[model samples]
Structures are given as structure tokens and as C-alpha cells.
Target: MENPITRPRSVERLVAGQATSDGAGVKLTRVLTQDLQRRLDPFLMLDAFRNENPEDYIGGFPNHPHRGFETVTYMIAGRMRHRDSAGNEGLLGPGGAQWMTAGSGLIHSELPEQEEGLMEGFQLWLNLPAKAKMCAPGYRDIPPPAIPEYVDGAGVRVRVIAGDSGGVAGAVRRPDTEPLFLDLHLPAGAGFGQALPAGHNAFLYVYRGSVIVRGAPVADRHMAILGNDGDGVVLQADGDSRVLLVAGRPLQEPIVQYGPFVMNTAEQIHQAVRDYQAGKFAAAAVQAF
Candidate 1:
């Protein structure tokens, strides 16, 4: 599909993270959202935090409430324990993921489980469909091994987390927006391009190294939002660069966000909270195909 946006240019967005305690008994970093207003459809927020010092991490996040959305927590280093009101419990290590669909409502929290005090991870909020907004809650905790990762040796390493990338399909169940994630690392001076379907929005986040997009240079810790209209995306690495490509079809829904909750209307958001508080949340039923 031809992209409506021109060849991707490197535009930098603001960056922000949160300070929280986890398993290791120390404080760590995490993200909330870079700029206000939803830039990506279906996706409402992105948080990235990293800490190496013991006291800087380890305490972990305590119990919190969520409704009308899906919370996806991904870990790249260290360990985290997950416990929720739905009776889901697990530990996530490097490459681990916990995808929880908090339909009507659910309360949960995550904390670090080790004493090293070093933890790094991310949590993303995805909007649920209106019809599914009242569906019962469900959980999916997948280890790093379940996610497909391979080296494209011509200097590309890819980890397919949700959709097909380089013939590798992410093991996670497809969501409403059909999200695609790729952990791409390229050699210095290498140029990479991919064919992206029309109507999909893509962004490149530089975890490390540097890249020159459309004659513009972007460094580490900066996120590049690509134009949605174009044939594909071209990223040229000026140095050994490691980046995350998060792409999904735009969600054309009205978003009314309040703190940790995202919904289509203020009344709907208010009703969601009331349902949870009144112990009236919808229960997840095991449906057979």
C-alpha cells in the first residue's frame, strides 16, 4: 500500500517517564505519555523508564485500577511480579509481556521480585472497542521465549511482538487495532526500509545509537513519528542504532481520557468508574468458537 505521508522524516517528540518502586526494593523509571492528545489511534499512552541503581528501583507499583482499556506491560531487563483482582499471577523477565484486557473494570498492581534493584520496562494503554468495552476481563502473560526474535544478519535483528515482520509472527493474540511491533537493530551506516500497508501509522523510537531520516539526525532517547501517507519508511543508521518500530492502523474513535482511564465520552468514562465501585463489572465468560 502506498503511504499518504511522504518519505518518513525524523521528527522528535517530547519524552517523559515516571518514578516508581518495584520488586528490588528500589525506585525505577517508566513512561506515561510524551505529549497530550492521542497521536496514535487505539493507542492512548506509552511509558518508558529505566534504572540501574538499586535504590533507584525495586519498590514496584502498588495496586491500581483500570477499566475500558487494555494494559500491556513489557519487560526488557530485571524481573517483575504481576497480581490482579482477577486472580492472575506471574513473573515477567526480559522479553516478557503481560497483556490484560480490563473490559468493564479490574484492579491490579506490579512489583519487583528481586533485590538487585535494577528493572526496566514499558506499559502501553490500548483502547477497547465499544462493544467489547463491557466484556469480562482476561489476562495473557507471555515469556520472552514466546516472542519471535531472529537476526536478519545483513545487519538487522527483528523481534516480532504482535504481527508479521520478516516472516516472523508475534505470538500475541491480535488486538482490535492490529498492532505491529519490531525491535530492529542496524549496523552503522546501514539503510533499512520496509513496505507498510496504507492507513497504518508507524513510529521509530531510538533506544540507543543514532539515525538520519530524510537528512535529519535523531539521537538516543528520542522518538520519531512518521508520516502516515507514504509507500514505506526508510531509516539510515549513522551509527549502531537500536530502535523500536510500533505501527498500527489509526483508530477513528473519540477519546476522553482521565488519568489511567480512556473512553469515547465523559459520561461513558464516569459510568465505567461507577460500575467498578458498585461491584457491577462484567465477568469474563469462556466462549467457544
Candidate 2:
């Protein structure tokens, strides 16, 4: 059996996300904002949206530009059609994901493929290192079957999205940020553990139900930032719960962001803006079907 977290980290604080709308006014909760970028280095933002009403998400996201970071869109329900200037097009359905690296720049749109029912998912912005901020843009469409998942003896199911868990590797991996993204579903009264580097910044966002970490209750739609003093974390489900566990090694470098552009300095941000305005962002192509 894989070794469990011996010293589980405690919750540093609980954060109530701010309700916001983006991309043609699609309603969402911005869980991680610009203010927390330093504390949660390598991760810029996290937006969660769950809407049953068609009016809330029908507009979807129109053509937008991004540079110097990566966008990971994971869909729990509903379907979204992705098209980009890189000549890439794909349909993201339930249990699928779209990973786009706007390394240098790109123009993309994510429109709804369905007219009704439930629309739920998250969009996470992971910052790139200084060295890779201006690299070639890329994209990947990861279907549900491509993602590595495992069910533990305690009836806890874990979907490893971007890190190693329970001896199962995720579909994508990065060396610089070394991000760990896991979607965990735990049964009532069950527990789960995952080892993490003591130096990495980590947090847990509970979505379905409540969970307890280090004796602190994390309610639905709330985020619990974990302390970095321990080797890992232990979570106990207060009920049948679904949570997102995310961690990454801090870049420790300067972060300067302007809208969808994230760079190391203000000058770089300015350059990105000028480049996008000059139509330089659409030059590169990413074959992401």
C-alpha cells in the first residue's frame, strides 16, 4: 500500500468565493482571485460554475485572448465546444477536460454544445514559469477515459487530473510547476489521504457536501487553504462529498497579471497586450482535437 500522510496539514483559513460573471456574462464563482496569487503561486485563478438555468450559461465564452499561462477546463456535466485561432476544435463533454497553454498567446471560445440541463465545471489558470511564459502555445483534449482514476478500499474515488495519486499517473504532467489536481468523491464517514510536498502550496475546495480537515469543517462552495508545515493532508467526509484537491510548487518569482495576461513584469504584460492587439497571438497553431 502507498504510504499515507503521517502529519496531516491543518486548515489555514476558509474562503468564501466571490460571485462573478465572465465571458458574455456566464455566471460563476471566482474562488481564487488575483490577491491570492502570491500565496498560491503557480496558480492564478479558479472559477467554478454550476447552473441549471439556460440563461445563466447560454451565452458562454466568446472569442477571448490569453497569454503567458495555461487554462484547464474540467466539466462535471454539460458540453462545451472549443475553437481557437490555433486551428484547433473540440467538444468537451461530461467528465472531459480541455487543457490549453496560452504560452505566448491565443484567441479561443468555449460555447455551449447543449441548450439545456445542468452546466457545471471549473476553469483553473495555472501560471507558467518565467522561462516558459512565451513558449509556443499548445492544447490538449482529455476525455474521461484518458484520465487515471482509482477507488480506494474506503470507497473513495479519486480522479487524478494532473498529478500522481495512489500509484496512478494523470493524463498530463508538467515539470516546472509540478501541479497536482485531483477530484475526490468520498462516501459518508469515509476518509482520504494524499501526501504532498511540505513546501508546496495546497488547498481544498468542497463542492458537493461538507468535509473536515484538521477538525475544520469545509462547507460546500468554500475553499480551505492548507498549511505548509505538514507532509500531506487528511480529509474526512462529513457526508457524501466531492472536493478538488490542488497543490503546486511555488515559483517564488514575480507575478504581474493584466486581465488574461500573466507575466513576470509589467513590461512583459504591456508587450503581451501590444502583441495581442497587433494580431500576433493568432500566428501560432496548436493541433488540439
C-alpha lDDT of all candidate models, in order: 0.69, 0.92
Model 2: runs farther than 4 Å from truth? Answer: 1-3, 287-289
Whole-structure CA lDDT of model 1: 0.69
Please count the clashing residue pairs in each candidate, in the order shown. Answer: 26, 0
Give each model a TM-score: 0.85, 0.98
Error of 1 at 250 (Å): 1.6
| Predicted candidate 2 versus true structure: per-residue lDDT over 151-172, tens digit per residue | 9989999999998999899988
Q: Estimate the TM-score for candidate 2.
A: 0.98
Q: What's every prediction's RMSD, in angstroms?
A: 3.8, 1.4
Candidate 1, position 129, lDDT:
74
